[model samples]
Target: MSGIYIHIPFCKQACHYCDFHFSTSLKKKDEMVLALAKEIELRKNEFENDVVETIYFGGGTPSILEISDIKLLIDTVYSNYKVVGNPEITIEANPDDLSPSLSFRRNLFEELKAIGVNRLSIGIQSFFEDDLQLMNRAHNADEAKRCLEFATQYFDNISIDLIYGMPNMSNEKWLQNIETALSFNVPHISSYALTVEPKTALKKLIQTGKIDEPKDEVAQEHFQVLVDKLSENGFIHYELSNFGKENYFSKNNSAYWLGKKYIGIGPSAHSFNGTSRSWNISNNSIYLKSIAENKLPSETEILSKNDRYNEYVMTGLRTIWGISLDKVEKEFGTDFLEYLLKQSEKFIADDLLYLDEKILKPTSKGKFLCDGIASDLFLLNLE
Candidate 1:
């Protein structure tokens, strides 16, 4: 149930709201491709005892890569690690890269399928021209529709990303976005609220009054609609932001949520191995040089007992798989368990949390605030 995440650090253009690590220029694309494969081969021993059940190509824009580059990377994974019979291989792509108008792009889906890629996570933030412009997405309204029209014919387990809480989006328009996505009949969807992160173009725009700030009340309204609409249509609200049909849940994401060990390759990527976590250097030049010199360009830290407990609480509260009260008592002792129940008393009394068969979970009223609630129960600066 382990996975590997490969970060692609190049994008055609920058999205206004994005604070992720990426370069707009593809000047070093060829060199990057080789470094990534070499890093994959270099880190094989770390997972010698674990079989990789998923391989996720995430990042600046994986769809921009040549099909040969993709094949080589997947092949490197096979050559180095013990992979499952049918691993869930996914690529995060933008619609501009998947447009069927270009000759090479027309064959992209088929070639990806031939090379063992079984899933596609398309970065389709919205379906309206205005929303697309606000987010500065690479694809327009028409391209989003056209790509899905063709992509659905090629890949079955496709998951598209949609952003809610845009400043000027109307309630009717938000619902329209949902309905249009439903029209595609895809099995999974991952949606998120558009937050103005610091240092990004989005934050600056908001500060200068170039764009209106996204309202929290509006976000809450959209979230309720998203959950109800998706659930009514047979999509399970498994994880807070992700909805999936039966047997179609993302294996890579599920493994990570359940606290499984995973190796992350490429610059600005993070990795966890049950007891500790590590992250690679964010600078591309440093990562390339280190890999060439047979060194891992990364930093590592071991998790303390309280840190592990805090992490479990944060992740558990956000998923349908609630925190197991029995496991808490068993692993963290009566003292920790008592502290948990005491800290959760107010939420439970407010009907925001409840105990079901000894498992602690958030009620529908509290799901949207799980992160805040979990923080209240954190084991911070205490024994």
Candidate 2:
């Protein structure tokens, strides 16, 4: 089974810490939507052997779209692609866009479900007004709570996104957010420690002395809190930033962690087949103009074996599943596999890694510093 990811690069307002590709202006929403529809048609033939199992609409905020726009995009995928029956279709929505009495919102969910969107990933970064305002998020605490209540009727497979480690957030408040999500019985929760990315508003605020820079100590403490709280609630820490109860793990994201092939469409969107990776240009107008001319608007890269192995190490080491030496030997050859084991020996001795049979996995103590550990294991040069 394969997956499809469509990027809807538009948002009503920019969050302070967000550096994702998006525009606050809606001038080209219609044009971009149309372009995305056509782009889906152009790339459908690329997934030759697999039936599409998951379709994720991710971006600045997919919830902001009109029902007609969503339907048009969905129709294009169905017409051009061999989408599997009962595909796990997901749309990333924001809380402010959901309203209980809005017929448009209700119909949007119904129509999307009718067209096979079975999951909803709502961007409810925080449920506290102060925290929400601090991050310049569009939704208030009340709307964030109500959105989930409104969504529960139509969709059971729901996930909420939360952020921690903002300057205004305290440990007590951070844990409270986790409690609130659990109280609502959310099946999946993706929590992340806030980082001020360069070129984002938060970064500028820090540079200008408008706000204090985020403390890494605070973020590290909160990360542990998240792990403890979620684990206590029976949510598996499946990936570095994801927690899911039972079988509610994100199939689309899991495809990425397992190095599965998927198509990505829209400006700044990324796609991967087994051998190569490609991404659309981040500029909006360029994407619209090119797709209108029936031209594909993406840059491609073919992966060398070493490049692919490093990617495998980067993605695999972050998960609950440890890197398997046997799989490495089979796929990457005995020499590369031996090199991986030799490199892992130091971290293993330092209690940062654990090996069972032939599989090497990170210990919980090693997870926080996983990036450093993974980077050290990369082959300087590989054939």
lDDT of 1 by residue, 142-242 (tens): 98988888889889999999999999788888999999999999999999999888889999889999999999989989999999999999999989899
Q: State which candidate has the highest TM-score.
A: 1
How do all models score by TM-score?
Answer: 0.98, 0.97
Pairs of colliding residues, candidate 1:
none
Residue-level error in angstroms, candidate 2, position 182? 0.7
Model 2, position 160, has a per-residue lDDT of 94
Clashing pairs in 2: none
Task: Report each candidate's C-alpha RMSD, comma-separated, in the order given.
Answer: 1.0, 1.4
State which candidate has the highest lDDT. 1
Task: Report, for every candidate in turn, its global Cα lDDT versus the true structure.
Answer: 0.92, 0.88
- By summed lDDT, the worst window of 10 consecutive residues in model 2 runs over 99-108
Off by over 4 Å in 2: 100-105
